[model samples]
Structures are given as C-alpha cells and as structure tokens.
Target: MDTPLINALEALKKENRISFHTPGHKKGRAYESMDDGGIQENLYQYDTTEVFGTDQLQDPTGAIKESQQWTARVFQSPEAYYLVNGSSAGVLAMILSQTKPGDEILLPRDVHQSVIHALILGDLTPRFIQPEIDPQFKIPKGITLPQVQEGLEKYPKCKGVLLTHPNYYGRPGEIREIRRMTREFGKILWVDQAHGAHLGLHPQLPLSGIDAGADLTVTSFHKTLPAMTQSAVLFAGGEVVDRERLLEQLNMHQSSSPSYILLASIEQGTRHYAKAGKEKMQVLLEAIESFEQKFRRLGLFQLDTAPGKDRTKIWIHTENSGRTGHEVETYLRENHGIDMEFSMPQGLLALTSIGNREKDLKKLYLAFEELEETLYNKVKMEKFSEKYSKEAKEGFFEKEVERDKKEPLGLPIRTAFYSRKERVSINKSVNRVAGSAVTPYPPGIPLILPGEAITRGHRDQLLEYEKRNIKVIGIKAGKIMVVAEE
Candidate 1:
C-alpha cells in the first residue's frame, strides 16, 4: 500500500520510541484507564455530524452544554466552551470580542503567531510589551508587572491586555498582579495558557490562569492533558468580558461543523482529569524528581531551572559537555530510541504529563547516563566552540537586550498583511516593512512581525538562526517577504 504517512507512523509505533512530546496521551495509553464508554475502542463508529441526539457546538443546549458545564466546574471557571480548532480560535475570539477595529490592545511581543492573526482579522493595532528573556536558556519568559504597567500607562487608551502565561518554556509570570492592575485600570485581562492545562492539577504546579483571575483564558487540552490533538477549552469569567460579544466571536472563529471525535476525546480527557489527574500527576512528578536526582549524581549534566518553572517540563543542557542540543538530540534518537519535545541550541526539552509513567523517566535517565559515559572518555567536541564564537554569542545576546527597546512599525498590521509583497534577501530587507511574520515553530513566537520595520538586529539574529539550521516559517531560499515600495 502507498500510504506514506500511515506507514511511517506505524513503523515508528513498532520502534517503541519513548515520547517526551505532546498529544499528551502518550500514544493512547491514558485511554486504557479511562472510562470512555467504548469511545476509544470505536472511534470510527463515533464519528458523526450534528444529528437528533447530538447538539450544535456553537449553540450548545443539550449534551455538549452539559459536558462544558461539567468541565467548567472541574476547572473552577464560571463558564467553559469546548474548541475543536485548538486554542488559536479561542485566542482570536478573545481579541475580536474585547476590542473594535483600529482600537489598540496591549500584549507581549513574544505572543504566539495566532495573536498576530487576531490583530489582522480584527483590524486592530498592537502595543507590544517585551517579555523578559531567560539568561541561561535564551528563551523568552513571561510579562512582568512593570512592563505591563508601562505599556498600559503609555497607551492609556488601549482597549485591554493579552498575555501568554508560562511562555512556552513553562515559566509563569505575575498573572495575579497583572489581573489586579487591569481591574484597577478598567481593562480586560485575557490569557493564552496553551501549554498549561495540567496546572492546578497538582499542588506543586503554578496557578492556572482561570484561578489567577483572568477575565478570559484559553487552554489547550492536547498540550499537557490526555486529550486528542486540536482539543482545547476556553473559559469566560470575572466581570470584564462581554458574554454576548464573546459568543458571537466564538461562532465566527470556530467551524460550523466541529469534530465529534475531538469532542468525545475532550470529554473523555476531562473525565480522566477529574478522576485520576492528581494521583497520576503525583506519580509523574516523583518519577521526574528521581530522574533528575539520578542524572545530577552523574556530575556531567546540567538541568535548566527557574523559580516558578513547571517541574513537568525538563530541559537537559549539554553546554558544559561541549555539545549542541541539536547534536545531543540526534545522538539520543539514533542511539537510545528516544524523542524529545524540542531541541534548542542550549538543550532539549522533555514535556511530561500524567500519561507518562515511571518507566518513561527511567528510560530517559538511562539514555542520558549512557550518553555521558560514552562521551566522557573521548576528546571534547570542538564543533560548539568553533560554530558559536565569543563575538557571535555576544551579538546574539545583544540582540535580545535590544528587544527591550521598542522598534518602529512601518504600517498597521492589517494593511501591511494585505498589501502586495516582493521577495528580497534577508539582509536587503532591513529597514523595509515586513509583509509576513518570521516565526519558528514548536515555540511559534515570531522574531519579526508583519508591518514592523526590519532592523539590523533582526537581520543578524535571523542570519544566526540560519547558520544554526533552525526552521523559520517566513524565509524561503534565503529570501524574505517585504512590502513592495510604490
């Protein structure tokens, strides 16, 4: 049979690779303990449209509404809605419902690409608050109270604020404080908690956005919960959100025919969360702690840590060992049959969930132990030092420091996005208006946004990413899309 994707997936399944990645069911093992009423066993049979028994997702009145109500109760939100289109639709709805066209909204510059799409679709202007960067990981953390205070004070007439809690690397910021500030200023607070569905499941984890008093919050069930892909939930609470307007945007952004299978999986996932999430989370955390303690005893590995970082997400750094994360990731896959969530220049990330078992952590620890033992006797790898020079490293971090200073926007996001564009080399496009966003996937934060004026710093950082062979979305054959001049 000429089934390329299915064949590959089946082959990989046969390989029994250890997963520290998403679609958080760990290859459907979570379903084994779930009380799914045969939904997991007969997924094909359950695939159907809105019929007599099935209620409409947009205007839920029957079973769907009941399910969502149960979910809201479980998550401690005032009202909850299921989304088959993932958190992207929920993010768009949040923006469109809160503000009108040409109105300005305050948000972090490190927002997911969906936030930029919302700006384009709503014909709105953005007042970006730069997020603080982690000095060790070189990844953006979360918005601070001072940054938000400055943005709101500078753009006093801005409609509201949108924030991404636990920004991709699992470090949460001051959502509680920011929520209070927004209320005092009579502004709405919307949270993109796409990677924090497991929060509040355990006492040790950081507070969930809903619990932090966000007026609106969107969480992806698939990211850290035992839900199928594209399954998510949006919560509406507090006094700021316009309920009627939010419902309108929900319908506008979501599909007319939502997936029944996805809905079933969400319901089943929610059931698991309600039943066994805490117990299993405790087990998973203990396992991870044991793995960390064991690996740290090896005396040759480094683990990334922050004050409020999620313990479920582990980052293994090879900088001290003189190997790039990309190199270590390749070695793991080829030698240890393990897959990670993502790899950066500094380290590889492993996203754990309730679905992960103790054995999984044991496997990871064994792999790292073997890697260190095997490489300890050999001469130190010079590729990292040769490739990343001291001057280049300084420039890379210098670009991050420069992000604290606001760059000029050449045109409004909506106008620049719809305008005609021409392809130009990355270096030649500096100071010209960007026609599209240059974003890296996995973390999905845009380095350059549409309608923003390109700077020499942007050019140098992107060039460095290219030299490191990172995958960026907007560049093709070394050319970038810039708005054509008259």
Candidate 2:
C-alpha cells in the first residue's frame, strides 16, 4: 500500500523550489557538494536510528559523545549537550534548572514566545526590560546595557537575567557591557542564542554569547547552521551552571528516545563549520552585498541596515511598494516559487547561510528585478500613517504601566490560568485581573498578561484590535477573560 507520507515527500521533491528559508542547507548542496564520494555516502548511510553501529542519544558514550565534545571545543564552551529538541527545550531546561517558583527573573520584552511559556510553566515571576524600538522600521532593537543595569537595580533580588541575543530580526546587542552589568548584579546571564549558531565560526560575525560571558546559552543549530531540524546545543560556561541539576533538567524536558538522526546531524553540521564555515560565510556575505546593490537599483524593497544587524538575514520593507509583506511573500511563493523564512505585516525576511549557492541568490535578485519593473510604475506606494504607528507604540508602553505596578493584578499566573475564568466585556473587564496574555504575535510581549489588571489604556489597545479585526486569544468573541470571582 502506498503511504500518504511517502507521497507527500515525492510531491515536495517534484516542486524543486529555491528555499531561501531554513535548515541552512538550501538545496542539500552542502552534502552533495562534498568532494569525497565515500564520505557523502557514509553521511547518508548513518542517517538512521539506534541500530548496530549507532548508539542511543541519551546515554551517548560513543560517536555522539565524541560529537558533543567536538562541538564544545569548536564553540569554546566548558560543556555542550546535543539538543534533539530545538533550543526551546534547552531554554526551558536552563530556566527550570536554575530557579524555582516565585523566584523573579528579568527578561527582555523582545524574547521569544517560548521563554514566556517557560516562565508560565516554571511559575517564575518576570520583570520585563524593554528593548529599544526603531520607530522608523517599526522593529524592536536589542537590549541596551543601561536597561540591563536598571533592571538589576530595580529587581535586586531577582535570580537571573534572560536575554535574546541577536534578536529574531538579527540585531546584536552590546554583550560585553551587559555581561559586566550582570556580573556586578551577581545575576546569572542566560542567553537565548537561538539565531546565532554560526557566530562562533566567524570572528568577523557577532560575538557568541559564551565569549560574551553568558552563563548558559542555547543555540538552534537548524537556524543559521547546517543541521537537521530540531537539532540544537546547550552550552554552559565555567562555574555558572550546576552540571548535575542541568543534566536532571535536560532529562526532564528532553525525549527519552531522542532522534539519532538529529544527534548525528549536529555532529556533521559542527564539523562542517569547523572545517569551512568562515570561508563559506565570507563568500556568502560578498554575494549578499552584490545582491543588495542590485535590489537597490530596482527599488523594489528597502533593506533594513540598522547597525550591528546580521548581514545574512536580509530584511526588506515592502510597504513602500504598495504591498504588505504577506502579499510579496504570497507572490514569491505562488508565482516565483521562492520560499522565505517569515513575512511580517511590515516586511519580509530572506535568510541566507554559508550553504546558499551563487545561482540560488541570482534567481532571487532576478525575480525581484522583474517584480519591480512590473509593479513599481503601476502601483502607487501608500505612505504608512505615522499616527497608527505612534498609537501602537503608546499602547505597548501603557501595558507596561500595569506590569510595573506594585500590586499589579495581585494574583498568581498559574492560579489565574487554571481558575474558573469568565468572559467579560472589554469595558467591563477594566480594573479586573487578566486571565491570559493578549499581545501582538510578532513582538509577542503581552499587553494583558495573567494577573495584570486591565486599565482604560488596555481597553483602548483591545478596542484597536477590534477596529483592525485582529484576533485576540483567550477571549470569547472580543470579550476578555477575567477572574470569575467578584
């Protein structure tokens, strides 16, 4: 009998679209481009389960152990563990290992949704550090050193500070200064280095979290490195993380029957980086620079050139082209057959890596050039209203006012989460404790987190959501969730 899964795989192979998306190796060229035929064949052969030669992932004392050691050496970390689960697991493990319930942690507002989930699961109190916002681009920038200093001062008893380095948009923060601030405050600096797996390979690239004095850092190998999906690494610095506790936490979160394919892919990807990552990345950077020039000439989309941003992760704002990022993304996928990483309301992101070929990028440049010629003259660019953008910015800060209050919503998150919550009208929910997190997904910082009392400003933001027809979760048809009690 023909299986549907096999049929889907065959269909995917038939499409043969250029992937400007993930797994780093766009078209399996890294493996196919190998000089040694025997090595390439062996690579494919060992991509199997825990068979005769291949050992189990959890109790790795053979090839997997060796691979982990090599990875640690390459990244210059004291110890590293292969994360069969993505860096999300590693982030949760690290946080759970260190702190207990009621322990306060300072988190950057721009942190990934996974971190927020960890906070909820661990029942940890979170004090947010607002990252600088680039109003012109409508993108949040990195956490400033002063912000870290201020957070530590404000929450002197807080257990740790969690940061997302080289944020999703690829903006790198001043790690050295932030490290100094954390050290002075005697707080463990846990870094979410998910988007920076390849940083250690090239010195010219942004500094790796480990080098910047992070206590524990997690890297998603599949993001910028040539690893299989869900393969990541958790790195620990000297005398910072408790090894025994970390191992126990890993066991708690990680799978018992971890995928051998993902574990082995970590080894192969690390080896590839150690051998030729810098050289390959240099070549890729050069190609990207040339492509940016070509796109500028076409005037299709304007690239975001914020200082210290990752050159490889190209972000292009298409609002000026009379199209939303979603429209451009749909056009590229359906018409041009080009797949991208993500498309925000404001812009589209095309992620490049060492594994991308010259031919692949040429296709992207050519496609954009043709698209520009066809649409630029016909479509009049709509100037995005500064008023709407300003209101959104003001709304974000207004949410923070409730978050910072001394008796802010005075209820435990878990208690509120699983409690007999009732749906109340947005206006009626004013001054009532929130039973959920309601915020924009791209930034993902909650405007109304569990236990935070809703205010008029909160009501205003929610009303704006209704005006724009944006879906608000944990609410019944525009009604907000509040504690069922009086």
Highest lDDT scorer: 1
How well does model 1 score by local distance difference test?
Answer: 0.84
The 10-residue segment of model 2 with minimum total lDDT is 397-406
For model 1, how does the per-residue alpha-carbon lDDT over 33-96 read when each residue is reduced to its tens digit? 7656467778888888899989989899999999999999999999998989899999999889
Residue pairs in steric clash, candidate 1? none
The TM-score of predicted model 1 comes to: 0.93
Those runs of model 1 whose alpha carbons end farther than 4 Å from true positions after fitting are: 35-37, 298-300, 379-406
For residue 321, give model 1's deviation from the true position in Å.
2.7
Summing lDDT over every window of 10 consecutive residues in candidate 1, give the lowest-scoring window: 380-389
Instruction: Give per-model TM-scores.
Output: 0.93, 0.84
Clashes of each: 0, 0
- Cα lDDT tens digits, model 2, 369-411, are 7668767565432333344445444454334333323335557
